[model samples]
Every structure is written in C-alpha cells, then in structure tokens.
Target: MAEAYLLEEVSNFTTKYYADNLPSVHNPPPRYNVAENESSLSLFQGQLGSASGATSKFLAYEEWRTIMLYVLTNLKETMSYIEEFIHQFWRRSRDPTSNEIDTLLKQGAGSGKPDFISWFKKKIDLTEVFGMEVDNEDARDEVDDAKDLQILERLHLDSDDDIPPPSDNLHDYVDMHDIDDETHEPAIIDDDDYF
Candidate 1:
C-alpha cells in the first residue's frame, strides 16, 4: 500500500485519499487507557552508553530534544495517515448527499461465556494447560496400609508373643562426668553464677 502510494502511476491525491480514510473502518477509540504520551524515557552518555548514529560531533547532552526530530516526524506521518484514512473511509461508506458519517464504532464483546467456562473448569479442578496432577494421595496411603497389614500377617505374631530386650544400656549408664581418668567431676562453665 505504501509502495503504491509512493509510485508515479497512482495520483498523489488518490493515494492521499485512501491514506486519509481507512481508520473509519477499523479503528476503535481508546481502550486499555492508552495515554497520548506513554511516559518518557531517559538517555545518558557514557564511555559505553553512546547514542545510536551519533558521531564525534555529538555532545554529552541533548536528552529528549535529540530524538524529538525523528519522533515528531514519525508521529506526524503516522497520525496524518490515520486521520486521512478515517476521512477517506467515511467518504466511501456514507450517502454523498448526507452530511452524517457511516462509521463502524465497536464496543466490548462481553467476556462472559469463555470466562464462565474457565471459572467452572478451575472450580472443578479438571484439566489445565499444564495438565492437572493425577496422583491420589489418599489412594497411595490406602495401598501403603494394605502392604503393612500383609507384612504383619506374614510375620505371624501371637497374642502372647514376647520380644527380647535391647542390648544398648539406655538407662543403665547415664552420661558420666567429663573428667580425667584419675578424677571424676562435671565440667563447669566459668560464669557469674556460682554453681
């Protein structure tokens, strides 16, 4: 489209005509809170942080002003094209005698059914894009319990069965005093309190 507009065959006025009009067909007004100014960006010049396409003639400064030429030119071209397109489209769609425009204004398509389905799916815990974990923890516990019962049954322990005592003297020997072989006394900490 741009190429055709720029070519010699297409009359400059006609190219301008289409360029002026297309937005009336497609463009809907500000959704997503698109502010005209999308906040400002910062620029700094350092040994490593040199501005692109800047030569030795460049200075340490310029800031937003440096890019303003390129930015404004591009913005102007883009906005002119958009407005021109809207005008051209309006010209095409409406009755020539009628002053009113035949614009295609649109509203939100109501995110209802898909949202409800998604919510229901999440509530039911069915499938996810990252699929749901299929493991049943309760089932695993039941299996473990059954295996334990089987092992106990195989061991055949009578109601009157007696078990042998453990050999490790649990209470027979207490933790003895930390002492020399010749002398036995608990190791004491040097503190303010007299023990």
Candidate 2:
C-alpha cells in the first residue's frame, strides 16, 4: 500500500511538473526530439520512453539542451526522494535506534545486485551526464549573496546597519493621565434617534 501511494505521488508530481513546464505534445516530430533517433539506452529508458518513435526531428540545440536539463533536474529530484524513502523504510522496519540499518546498507553495497547503498550515497553530477555544469553549494550561495547585495544597494540600505529596537515604554507615546476617568451611563435612546 505504501509503495503504491509513493508511486502515485511521484507519478502525479512528475506529470504536473512536465505539463506546467514543457510543451503540451508528448511526442514532438522526430526532428524536434533527439530521443526518437538516439540508439543509446538509459537506465530510466522505460520511464522516459525508448527512442523508437516517428516524429519531426529538427529541434534547435538550445531548446534540446533546455529539455535535457529539465529532464535531468526532474530525474535527480525524483531519485533523491526515492533514496530517502528507501532509507526511511529500512530504518523503520529494521532498527529505529540502532546502527543495524547502516550495517545492512553497507553489506548490500557489494551484493552485485543494484547497489542501493552506493546509489543512495552517490551524488548525481549533471556535468558528467550532459556536459552542462550545475552550480555547487558555494556557487549558489555566492549568487544568492550577490543578488541580495544588489537588492540592498537598489533600496539604498546598508547591510551592516541594525534595525532599531522597538520602543518598550508605551507611556512615552501616550499620556494616560489625559484620558477621562468619568464613566458615563448608557443613554436610553427613543425611536426618534433612529430618524
């Protein structure tokens, strides 16, 4: 049941993301779709579809690159989720508070079957996959800091300046003594007041 739910969630998420970001047509002309002509098989060929469809096959290099990037990014994120799910499942089912799960994962590393441990631990490199380098943590942080600095400069604000503390003395702003102490009785209004 859990596996089915996870599969459904992943499928829905992927479908929604593709629909929102990519072209509406699933199969573009062979000329516009590189996958159609490429004979190379990928590990995810089943999910991504094998290159055996007929369509126009003339896509611009930039457009093809963008599509590849989108697919690779989605694949990386999906794989991360799957890895986390497997880890969590193993941890909860085997040992919640012991290192047994880790031992088992390490043991599975050399099992010759799909190395779950290595796949879980290994980070995907987009550059190696598609010759396009992705920003690392440091580069991302630098870009973010540059953007923040630009925003601050545009607003004429100094990054080092501290925000003034909120005033703690309310009496300094409001004169409580000037307030009337009289308690007026409620007036009984006649119907004439409505007019």
Candidate 3:
C-alpha cells in the first residue's frame, strides 16, 4: 500500500509540474507556441516562429532544457522529502523502544523464520511493486544524464526577452557538486556516436 501511494504521489507531482509551467496549445503566450514537433521527446517544448515562418529547433531545445532543469529541481526536493520520510519510518520501526519485533515475535508471527531479521525479510520485499521491478541503483544512469544537462550553460535564452535570474538560494536546495566538481565541460560526442 505504501509503495502504491509513493508511486501515485510521484506521478501527481510530475503531472502538476508540467501543467503549471508549460503553456497549453489552447493558451499559448504572445510570441511562443506550444511546440508542434511530435518527434521532439523533450518536455515543455515551445516554438518561437520567426517572421519568415522559419522555426528553430535549437530554440525549442533550449527552452525545454530550462523548463526541464526547473522540473528536475522540483523533483529533487520532492524526492528528498520522500527519502527523509522513508528514513524516519524505517528508523522508527527499528527503534528499540518501538518493540515492533518483540510484538511480532510475541504473536508467534515467524513460521520457518525464527529470528527478527529473517522474519522482517519476509515482511518487506523491495525488489518489485505492482509487477514492476524497482531498482534504486538505476539512479546511476539518471545522475549521469543530469550531469550531461549543464544548467549554467542553458540558464539564459539568446533572444531579446528578459530572463529571470536563477534564485540565489538555489545552491541551498540544489547541489551542483553532484557531478564531478573539477570538470565543468560537457561530454564530447563523436559525429557518428548517438545516445
């Protein structure tokens, strides 16, 4: 039940974020149109059509990158909160004063598993939820991908429009050091190489 709740909360968070920030096709801004490029996989893609009727893909990518960074920032906060809550719950469940294991043992809960550790192992399985395998180690790939997105480089738009300065307190919430601190450059890709 907790696993289901967690998944639902995460889904709602992601949905709400995009709904609030990215404008819909029915209600686009003055200069920008909700991007019509179905091939573009990036979130919050907006196209600013030139007077010549030429659309720049780079502009859409740039805008999407900024919007995605904001969403990632928000997701980081949400994940942190959820992680803290999980930690608290785990700590409380294992606290000696709680006597959870004692109560379980008193009720003769263990069948073949005699010890608390063995019994607890049977109670919770982190491997899968709702038929889908849940792997925490998958975060390694996400970290690598996030490092690829250099927020500093994409912070401002090239257009004449005024870009709001990123929050000074962003450092408090976002750890820029998640990727290697010494390297500031993005990974170079060969002409033939593709992700």
Q: List TM-score per model, in order.
A: 0.12, 0.17, 0.16
**Which run of 10 residues does model 3 get worst, by summed lDDT?**
113-122
In candidate 2, stretches whose alpha carbon ends up further than 4 angstroms from where it belongs are 1-53, 77-195
* Residue 175 alpha-carbon offset, candidate 2, angstroms: 89
| Candidate number with greatest TM-score | 2
The list of candidate 1 runs beyond 4 A from truth reads 1-74, 92-195
Clashing pairs in 1: 19-85, 20-84, 20-85, 21-84, 21-85, 21-86, 21-88, 21-89, 22-85
User: Candidate 3, residues 1-195: lDDT per residue as tens digits?
Assistant: 999999878865665456534654434445654446454434334563455665556558647655543453345433443343234233343443335533433322333222222222222232222244323233223323333224323422232121233434343334455434567433444678663
| lDDT (tens digit, per residue) of candidate 2 on 1-195 | 999999877865566457333543442334434343243434244334445867788889657645553454356445553455346345343433435434443333232322232333222332443255432232224323333334323433222222222234332223344444573323345799799
What ranking of all candidate models by TM-score puts the best one first? 2, 3, 1
The most accurate candidate by lDDT is 2
Where is model 1 poorest over a 10-residue stretch in terms of lDDT?
Answer: 101-110
| lDDT values for all models | 0.33, 0.41, 0.39
**True-structure RMSD, every candidate:** 29.7, 24.2, 25.6
- 139-169: candidate 1 lDDT, tens digit per residue: 2243233333343344342321222222332
